[model samples]
Target: MFLTGEMLIGQQSVTGSSAPISAINPATGERLEPVYLGGSEAEVERAATLAWQAFDAFRETTLSQRAEFLNAIAIEIEALGDVLVERIIAETGLPRARVEGERARTCMQLRLFAEVVSRGDWLDVRVEPALPDRQPLPRLDMRLRQIPLGPVAVFGASNFPLAFSVAGGDTASALASGCPVIVKAHSSHPGTSELVGRAVQKAAAQCSMPEGVFSVLFGSGREVGAKLVAHKFIKAVGFTGSFSGGTALMNIAQARKEPIPVYAEMSSSNPVFLLQGALSTRSAALAETFVTTLNNCAGQFCTSPGLLIAEKGALLSSFVESASAFMNESSTNTMLTPGIYEAYEKGLSLLNDNPNVRRLAQAKESDLPNQCRGSLFSVGAKDFIQDESLHEEVFGSAAIIVECDNFEEMVLVAESLEGQLTATIQADESDLGVAKHLMPTLERKAGRLLVNGWPPGLEVNHATVHGGPFPATSDSRTTSVGSAAITRFLRPVCYQSVPDMLLPDALQQSNPLMLKRLYNGDWEV
Candidate 1:
């Protein structure tokens, strides 16, 4: 497979008319080959028009057929092989092992959604027979089932090029739920996005899917994305990026004459709470694990632990000493892009200039371009509570420790924090009372509450939730990962007094799909 620097718009490889964008190797600061041309409103119109045309036919596809299409996408991605791996490494400067792991995760999630589709649980079908009784006015027959919202617009993320890019979770879940997709590829990894986009295009062809089922667009600035979000045919959106980008999309979607839902995952400073009992017994071990989690992938993950809260004492001092030792030994890593590296440096400077914040430890400096050195800082609990700047995400490997005077202050710190993707508690059996006290506050602040675990290792399973309240995600009721993610692209519709033959397969009287459904106020398997 070769890179062509063309946009895939419904089985057509069209050249763009806007300014071209190229990928640069962040590790060595070298330009990559084959610059990709940017798209304009005309391209957006073409893609959205095709997507709307294919929606009715694609949404009516059988369960087995749609599931097979998803599985075919996974197979096609795996077939890309080393070509995909090398391109991803060059584009994002991530290590080969990490890239390989992300590729596996990407395929696993696609297959997982395939299985979810085959099970037919996402339909949530229900039926109620007509009652022609004489006691009261006769009731008409009514049936209900969830249906896919129209076309969707997905914005790729810069950090995870494979698992969260052109054919990532948003695309997989949206397709599984029977919605056509139009992707706005991230500018930082155009070559990688093109490779994956071609694979998806091939899969649609091999599976005999609609021609306009999926399309990929490239844009260097906000023009293409804004046009896609504001288009009348795009019924919903799935975004993963900065707060400014996500909020901008949300505002555009809401301003439309027919407003749409934007499931945008923006920012999170996933906080970790260190309890007294666990810290006293395993301070050294806990410090080692904390630093390890903090430095993983240069702390580029959305779920990275950015804030730590603990009571002030010798136990806390020992934990700090051990953590500082590990931080000093940590190696510098190349970031995803030059712009990301610059933003990280500016964030460090802000903390350095603050009067209440004191630097605790920092890794050795490196002369390499786009390098990130792990850093740790500390501030009093009162200062953290009063300063809102301490709660913002830095998007790199930097963490803050809030030293509290007592348990009450620790609770107050947790209460003062903003919404997060995760909140972790390091506790022992004796610390259950303290952990119990903090549970309600954490439950309100974070989407996923962890006991004795880190937050970076996200699992692609049924029960896992990769979303949260407010800035963590635009809508708290939905998740952007796991089996439940399909619900984000679906809406319930009810049929009243419709004849049996005129109903959809899932809502028919014969129960053709063998799905677990609510029948006449009773559950039937």
Candidate 2:
């Protein structure tokens, strides 16, 4: 694999003819080579056309073949090893250890999806036998199975460069679901993107997969990406970014001549609820854990706890003191990029200027460029309930504590929140009654609920859901993480009165893959 700043398009190396784009080291504000040419609309068209051309063949591959191809991608990525990790660290301003861990996660998840493919459960095959002499007319033989939704356009993420980028969950899941993928590399990390993109290309070639099964492009402006989204051949989209960016893609997809699905994991101000009992028992410990989780990655994670709801009391005061002590001693950490740092500063300013909000804590200094200082704010429940601005996600190490007067006020505060990726409830046996009361509301407001723990790191597995209702994501029905993420790029298809000879393998009676499936109106795994 080589870094040529050339886009990979269906086994072809395309050097863009538009303006050049380069990766920048966020920590030092220095630009790094190779300077990638900005991709044009024509390139996007070419990729989409090729992907659609390849889809029929690619999607028809046996499960073992697709699984092996995914495994090959993981192996190729591992082969890159240190080069990949170091480049990601410099490009994203993340630490060496953190970058290494992310790279490992990237490979781990790819292999996980490979296992999912081999298992064949994703086909979701169901069958019903014909009842030729039934009372209400004979029920025709019918079989149901899932099929790929064709080519997918994935927008690499800025935060998790590897796990959510060129070969990230979006790409991995799309590929696993048998969709040819076209990735628009995030501008902040083109070098890293190129490396990983090349690894995928090598894997596809090595595994004898069709060309255009995976393509990566570099775009300097929104036109290149928007063009990809609006293309008629792209059947679905996968994105992880800002609300504006995600919605832009969603609107383009919806307005298309043939509308497509857009699975966009957007912003979230994950809220944490501290019940009276939990706060009374260990407010100090809770505060300590909150500060630590709040400061992780300088609070860039989508699941980072950004708001707190609690009733005003001595315990709440003690918690604030503990949090304040930690904030005072906290040192500024370098953020992902200058744009993000600037946005964070503006968010902090919004909190600082709000008349109803009081500053709860602030770090002493922001001594370096692109460094983010931790801050906390507090406001009365009445103001939080009234001001919609308070609900907007700040996207950094900043949070607001809503002080409610009583249980009813706390419930009101909970009811006022917008959709989130996660919502936490810190409770004990004594608070279970109120906690139970809050469940219905919380379930409606969030995709994942937590008990006695802050939301931060997400586990990538079969049951994990890294999605929520808007503005957390464009569609709440599908997740953008874990094994279930594959469903987003697949659609259920039913075959009726089709002979066994013509039936899709998964729907055939023999069950060649030996997968558990519904048979004769009985449920199966």
Candidate 3:
């Protein structure tokens, strides 16, 4: 089924003068539908004005009312179910199961934020009573509260249409925080984004939300996206895509007269370290896991293990052989988009041409359509660490094996790594000694640390951090996935000497919202 774009403003769908952009099915390379691109700069300004108008009232919405709105959005998303999943699969060329999983994750994230808002304390307000007996007598009570940052600009990611697009984390968190959203749909899967945008509008209308509370813009060119970020009305931005693309948006945000925070999750080479002892213990098991990790979703995941560090030994050799054999035997190979397919082809060609890199395994066929499979490459630790190009992410079903001469070489390789989303360690009890020594260095290099597992499957919980430093993410303190994501949509504000009734719900002494908070260094329920 094809879905077309209709501007969602003031809780309604409005047409614009912008032409249509074709949304293609990556799996079959067929055009699914043409979605309407957004109109000129004036339209964007109008939308922003609407959002600013909505924010005046929406920000004052009671916690219970906001909770109901968010919960309704979650329910609407769940109700879409298979229809939404199939559309995502058809548009993005992802498998049905993967799309369904993302849909569930998207719904879960919405519901999670709903629950978080329901509790009210995510605002994390604190109150300290004044003391007259102290040497430096406190004259007044002190309170801290978190407030919405006004309109948010969200850029949809090509890889995760459901999880990072219209109804994705950015929208969910922003709405939950009472900030209006204007999403710039990814050109690759505009159809899916349109459908999801409809769901968001449905939820908004059902909850009596303002028309400007949510808006979705479609554009084939970068100009529209640039204009959205550069707009003065936009208070912040949320993005998930390639390092170059995210960085470009960040540059635009930074260049603004009044700079805004751009929480952009860029690229990362999630490295996997396999200790010699673990390899000796369960080389076959390790090989099977490696194959699964490399081939999972055709290795398109941002957290996919792109670099594998292993000690030079017979076990490591056997693991590589088994992994290559398994990958060759696996028949399932379809990319999410033609752009991804082309990128994969170019990355493989570049690796093949590298003098220091050896193609450990190549797919048997090259002329195949979307049936193209992943490949494996190996290089000595000296070469892998010395070549800066080797550290860059290829964004495909390819793994680079770096053979280290000893534990020290492994440590050196680990130390040499740039910022990463995750760094995995496959080891047993004996390897803990080395892990202990490496943990400090790894902690400095990565945002998340994993043990005996891969990093592709991200959990949408409180602890999950889908971000890292620099290349992994534009900022280290923010994440694009998980409950912590709400932080990006909010900023703290302190009110002093304000009347109890005049203060925000978060700062009122009555604690009318009853939200959770950290009170005097203690967690208050």
Model 2 lDDT vs. the true structure? Answer: 0.91
The TM-score values for the models, in the order shown, are: 0.99, 0.98, 0.96
Candidate 3 stretches with Cα past 4 Å from truth are 132-138, 366-368, 516-525
Order candidates by TM-score, high to low: 1, 2, 3
Best by lDDT: 1
Write the residue-wise lDDT of candidate 3 on 67-132 in tens digits.
888888778878877778777777777777888888888889998888888777678888765555
Give candidate 1's TM-score: 0.99
Candidate 2 lands at a TM-score of 0.98
lDDT of 1 by residue, 1-525 (tens): 899999999889989999999999999999998989999999999999999999999999999999898888899999999999999999998999999999999999999999999999899998888998835688788899999999999999999998888999999999999999999999999999999999999999988889889999999999999999999999999999999999999999999999999999999999999999999899999999999999988899999999999999999999999999999999998999999999999999999999999999998899999999999999999999999999899999999999999999999999998888999999999999989999999999888999999999899999989998888999988889899999999999999999889999998888898999999899999
In model 1, the Cα lDDT at residue 72 comes to: 88
- How close to the true structure is residue 117 of candidate 2, measured as C-alpha lDDT? 92
Per-candidate clashes, comma-separated? 0, 0, 5
